[model samples]
Target: MQDNGPSLVCAPPAADARSGIVLGEDALTVADAARFAREPGDVPIAIGEDAALRMDASVAARDRLILMRRPIYGVTTGFGDSARFHLSPEKTTELQRNLIKYHLNGTGPSAPVDVVRAAMLVRANCLARGYSGIRRGVVELIVDCLRHGITPVIPERGSVGASGDLVPLCYLADLLMGSGTARVDGEPVPAAVALRSRGLDPVAFEAKEGLALINGTSFMSGFGVLAVHDAEGLCAVADLGTALAAEALMGNRSHFEPVIHRQKPHPGQVRSAARVRALVRGSDLCLDTPQVLEANPDVDGLGVIPLGRPIQDRYSVRCAPHVNGVLADTLDWVRRWLDIEINSTNDNPLFDFATGRVHNGGNFYGGHVGQAMDSLKLAVASVGDLLDRQLAMLVDTKFNHGLPPNLVRRVDPGDPAAGLHHGFKGMQIAASALAAEALKLTNPATAFSRSTEAHNQDKVSMGTIAARDARSVVELVTEIAAIHLLAGCQAADLRGAHLLGLGTRTGYEVIRDHVPFVDHDRRLDEDLGVVVGLIRSGALVAALRPHWDADV
Candidate 1:
């Protein structure tokens, strides 16, 4: 049913917070889902008219198959290894209810509210495609919960990414029946109470309704969407950090020159280099090749006049585009794959009205998300390592040109407290620790697939674990990027913020406003956290946006 999905990924407009977000057989962008997930007040959900028609027709097909009393997977027969067992039509509803009850085995921490909300939206979108055969009213109940801001407390763990993230999805299904816990405005409450207070009633499971709700890739896809979104932002922030570091080190700007990237011309590399160049457009501190050569020109015909400093910067400063380029390029394809996975009807026993057949298959497998997230985390961690190295160079005396050692805030040479203060040294150590942790998680989660469900599902996707790991890496790298930015801003201050490049000056001022210069040793843990907030909220990148194109 998937025809290479959408070939393009132009981000759709942000979902209107006041107006309802429309869920149908259409594309839902990362920006839109993120908006709906975190918008403070309740945002309504609307089922598209065509999607409603499709849902109606699909339910009709399910009823038609039941009339003949034929055996259909999860409809008349038992689930998993018990499929050999048969059931009467009267008992199918009971079987479905039992399905939800048995799989309430999810354990560990509750998923973040954003992940939960995004999962709910993605699941509703899948059903809106009209192949799952769920009752239209049941689907409406799910939408109403979203509209009323009642999100199920799904565990972040316990999903193997096969058989439709069974454990976590079971919790979501149970919520529909008003039997689980939900969060209202960030406070936990009984699902029954939340629904009742919002004027919604508990839904009873019908023949296929429970199975339809609990079977799909919603959990993994939700995390993937957010991870991809954050990874993109991290890449841009990394470039800004590079620009700031270049200015602080008085490094050569020739590395990001258009002609250098033009030779290779990988889209990501080209764009990444462009962003750095644009950020440092009119800077005097970062010297061009000719400027450095002119300053150290040979005075006599004797070869070898000491240039004092190296002609080029280290790899972390010079090869940043190649590193961040991989992430930017990986996102292009990952977005395409997620476009297909989220929009697909991935539940089992799909009802196809055109051929008058109820097809039972393995559409619920989440291999695509698993692989995409694994690849994404690997790239993000690499960028984190790159940013860490950049931060390392920004503070060290051997590498930071003539900047103060450890970027100490210009204490007089012989002052009693001059040698006692250490600035950003602790931040560099913290960044290294975070970078190591992020790298450790890059090992593929999909490679550790387990055999379960009585071996009825012998091979599994493990996509959910991978998506979660990717989210972890993105988060850790965000902290690393924060430290990198703080150090970059500190280094820029040492060199005089006014001398920073056009775009980097804007980034410098934004960071400096929140965190002033450290005249002496002080607790900077709070400063790290504040910059982390700036990075995640896109505030740092947004400040630089006026100087560069929005796409950067």
Candidate 2:
């Protein structure tokens, strides 16, 4: 359905929010889902009339099959092991209700409200494809729940990522019937109470409605959408971080030369090199190695500079493009895969309109998402490693060129607080600890597969867990990025602000706007928080968006 109709007034408080995205049998990109998920106000959603009509047609086909007693799966028969048991037509409603009730076994802390909302939106989109045999009224209720801020309190655990995300989805199904808990305006309450407060009614399960609502990959897809979005933002910020670190270390920009990159021509590497070049352009802090060598050549005339100030920068300073470039490429790949998954119809017994038959199969397996998330975790953790290494370099006198030890401003030796004032010493340690945690979370989710549901659902994909792990990894890495930004700015200050590149100079000023130069040691917790907020808020990335366009 084309999403161009007037939206229903689902909630007065949220009524004036952005106009709803119409859920039809069309593409719902990952970026689109992320935007809708992160909307500050409740973004309204509407069912497309064309989608409703298509769904009505599929519903009619299901009704015909039921009247013929064609013995369809999940419609006339029980689910899973009970698929062998045929049910009478009168028991169809009970069968659907029982399907949801039995699968309400999810257990863990509640998923974030945004994740829940995204999941609902994804599921609604899947149903709108008109292949799930669900009625338009059911789709409206899903949209109503999201618009009125009625998010189901879904648990974080359960589900093998095969046969759909059944456990959490059952909670969603339970909420539709007003039998579970929900969050309204960020407060937990009975689902029925929340719905009633919004002038809404609960729905009773019909023939295929229960199965249609619960049988899909919405939970995993929702997490993937947000994770991919954040990963993209992180890559941009990582570029800023690398630029700041490069300038602070007085590292040579020779490594980012196009001549060196053209030989490899990896798209991500070329892009990363370009961003670093742009970010560090016009920076006086970077070493002019060619000029230095020209002025002081070796006595043997090998075209080499004298062995002073070291011939080259350390690996952390020189190999940043190689490290961050791979991460950039990985994020781009995962985004493409998520774009396909978010728009896909991942439910079983799909109604094939052209063939006029229910094609029952395992289109719901989340192996692709599982692998993408696993790959994402590894890449994000590597970013943590890169940032950690750079932070360590910034604090140490041995590798920081001529910067003061621990990045402390050179104080009077006779001053009483000379040795006591340790600048960025504690901040570097905190960054290290966070990097360690992030690296430890790189375990692959596909390695933890388990058999469940009477062996009928054995060897299921642990994609949800993988996606959650990737989220945690992203969080830790963001903190690490914050620490790097803080330390890099401090190092830049010691080196002289006038020496910084155009983009890095602007970034340095942005950091100092919230946090001042550390003349003496002070509590850095608040400073770290402000920087992290800036990163997560996308402000830092946006400030340098022009510099990052090449990387994107």
Candidate 3:
């Protein structure tokens, strides 16, 4: 649970990797953000040579719009409501600088370092395609910041998820220009000092470079990608946790039989049922025969009596697969959107200078990412709600079969408070509080919108809020799962040394490693924290992957 081993390292990238994209299948399992903050390799940033040549030829064919008289949206005019303001060629560079400086209004707590790094990576990748018309030097600055661990202090709020996450990204652009602030080697410093310390000069804005830098959905998309990736892990853990819960409860495995799954055959439901069956396969308690006795013939006739608590367990234990299976299905939907978002070109007013054409488009709207992230948060919260219910069942005497109340300590009747002690009262309370917070955070932020900046952003997508909410939900879900694991392990121990399935055994081993059984209810919050840490570090996933694969 509390692994004191060395931290997981970042393994080398595979040979067939592309520039700026860290492929997940072959990449090292990054357990912490510090691993990603280290300098990356020399991935080149190149202009689209083929597209540039075509654009050059197209520019040659157009003499009607001469260089001195030509006008471009961001190139020769102010942005948004000020688009009517035209500028001479001499003022274009100054205009770009002014654009970045004026829009730096992002406020709130800074995002986690990894998210900042991810945003940098997303922005760099978008620029690498060479459609934004920015010089290669500008893109390289973003790459350098990421490589050298000089992440700009980007606030978490103030993004409309349209018009390219303007306010939030301006904070990043401003730092690159040596005019804002950034975190250098985990210490806050002036942007100018941070850049200078790295022997890098702040980049000056060019014709369309400022607009290109700030006019994109990198903020929302980057956070969404991170949230969705973490949600996938949570979904997997939810399945594993549900299976372990079923095993601890000695619930009917018939519900997960192949025949039962074949009749309906929803993919998530079938997969969840199969996983539960595998985890309960070698469980001796699950296979134990029910005790039966014939009633006495003395009074009234005779009746057969069934024993061993009851024939069926409570719904929390019996219905876990169905509850967690829905989350698995929701994750599948979120993954599709994330895949498309990561590969999308979301900059607005795309240019084809070679063909002498420009297309203003809806690429700036973040509806896709916003909706996906909103759904992901709700799904993860639902998992937390399910886990909370299961944990309650594990601790409540009514549902715990013959186990001790709250799994507490028992002693001789003569000694009331001597050897007798209470059990997971504090832990159950913590679980309830955490579940309440998770439910409170379930209100989808994407559905709330307000016009701002003189109604220029009349219809907004609060994708940033959705992402932040999802992150909070992830923490709450991890805490709830920790409580469930602690309680389930206790329940299993109380039921005697019955052989458990591979997955449940691994989970028990994880708990035994750090927090021992609750002989007495000492401080439980500390133990819960340890379990939460283990879950967050992917220790559970690594331990259970072998068992999961063997079953399939």
Indicate which candidate wins on lDDT.
1
Task: Check candidate 3 and list the clashing pairs.
Answer: 55-354
Candidate 2 lDDT tens digits, 103-219: 888898899988888899899988887778888888889888888888899998988888879889999999999998999978999999999999999999888899888888889
Q: lDDT per model, in order? A: 0.86, 0.82, 0.69
TM-score (C-alpha) between model 2 and the true structure: 0.93
Per-candidate TM-scores read: 0.95, 0.93, 0.86
Candidate 1 lDDT over residue span 1-552, tens digit each: 332123311233345656667676565666667667767355667877667777887888898998889998999999989999889999988999999999998889899988888888889988887888887788888888888888899888888888978899998999999998988877899999989989999999888888898889999988988898888888889999888888888989999998999899889998999999899989988888888887776758877667765679999989999999999999999988987888788899898765568998998999999999999999999999999998888889888888888888987779888789998888899999999999999999999999998999889999999999999999999999988988888888778888888999989889989998877889998998999898888888888877879534
Instruction: Please give the lDDT score for candidate 3.
Output: 0.69
**Order of candidate numbers by lDDT, starting with the best:** 1, 2, 3
Better of 1 and 2 by lDDT: 1
TM-score: the better of candidates 1 and 2 = 1
